[model samples]
Target: MATENNVLLTDTADGVVTLTLNRPDQFNALSEALLAALQDSLAAIAQDDSVRCVVLAANGRAFCAGHDLKQMRANPDQRYYEQLFAQCGRVMQSIVNLPVPVIAKVHGMATAAGCQLVASCDLAIAADTAKFAVSGINVGLFCSTPAVALTRNVSAKKAFEMLMTGQFISADDAAAQGLINHAVPLDQLDAQVDALVQTICAKSPVAVRTGKGMFQRQRVMSLGDAYDYAGQVMAQNMMAEDVAEGIDAFTQKRHPVWKGR
Candidate 1:
């Protein structure tokens, strides 16, 4: 994925995979090829057992400005727009559906669907100077799709306000609004992201994967149904070798050596 002029670049180290958006000149806009690349990479990561975590980073000064507006203007077809939005939605859902956690390493600005990318992630860490917005309305278009992910991550009123006003918020405000996990100095952004990645990598991969799937599925369930489903999941988790090893390690006052991912 690191080929010359590749729209997406990928690197893996220490059970962590970093996927970098490579459209620097275009501010990492999610063009058609870029969207396809993202979907393909995420699909592959879903099956890769060695990948304990994923970091979504960008190469440019701007994280992502959103969809490729020029491309959209070139087509100007309703059907094409429908398919494009659908594809973008799948990419967002793919992030939420991936077995391992995805952390957005945000810098500069992330607006519209770019901000949706941050929302789709399980966690996000942004530089203090980074900015976020759902600014489709500024162009006379509504950010209907980004609103889906945004509202799920942030309060309904705040999400609506961003959509309506087309205003940007600083990274710290994004964190306070629940759109991102933390915002640190630009120089320390990588360190903060790495600290979180290391923490996740230290946990049992089996438990992490199982919990992620269950957490997503049970969110839409009724209270009683959610409890029932969680109980079943926990019961099954107890049977995993890693769980047994973890309990044994706790009793023995030692670190657990996980057996399965």
Candidate 2:
């Protein structure tokens, strides 16, 4: 039997944990319930060292259509929008800051905050039929929340174009712009993501954690400071048992047994 969490379906096996957003009828839009569910899921996974990798997917035609517009329309008040966007920001931050690697599995349209969700992941793979957009501008509302992650993933000029035009872009364009890693046929989406996850999950979890953390933290630092910070991290990682075992295994020509230290 599958153990399901509210707003999400979670399954753990082979060092990989898959978390699927469950509101397919709404294209898995982010509502208060979905946000709360995701927050708790991330927090729980953070505590489980056995979870070496995370696959963020959804059960829907569209991976995510962005924030629940119905909720936004009902609220109307600026304060409601502020609070909702704030929660979206927090969820994105959690995904990026989480210790384990997160891979976004996108199969269809991922617009507005949905695009932000894809960008927030450490890596993303989309299907050939997939489409992406930041179309909030079409409705006279800028996709400010999405801009936060999109700008970091794509070049400044490219990101601005997407935000300003709100035009839909194909999966190929997303990968070329660095917003997504790979794009394959819809039929191959699962295999593609699974292979990518396997490639990452085979690595030493400790090293992966250190590398992911360093990568996330160094993005905004000055070049010199970034190098210095990375050096310190390298030194610290070197002293960890996992690193020592890894090195020894290389010399002995044997598979490394990671202790997750």
In model 2, where is the ten-residue run with the lowest total lDDT? 1-10
Q: Give lDDT per model, in order.
A: 0.94, 0.92
Model 1's alpha-carbon lDDT is: 0.94
Candidate 1 lDDT tens digits, 25-121: 9999999999999999999999999889999999989999999999999999999999999999999999999999999999889999999999999
TM per candidate comes to 0.97, 0.97
Off by over 4 Å in 2: none
Model 2 per-residue lDDT tens digits across residues 154-216: 999999999999999999999999999998999999999988888888888889999999999
Cα error of candidate 2 at position 203, Å: 0.8
> Could you tell me the TM-score of candidate 1?
0.97
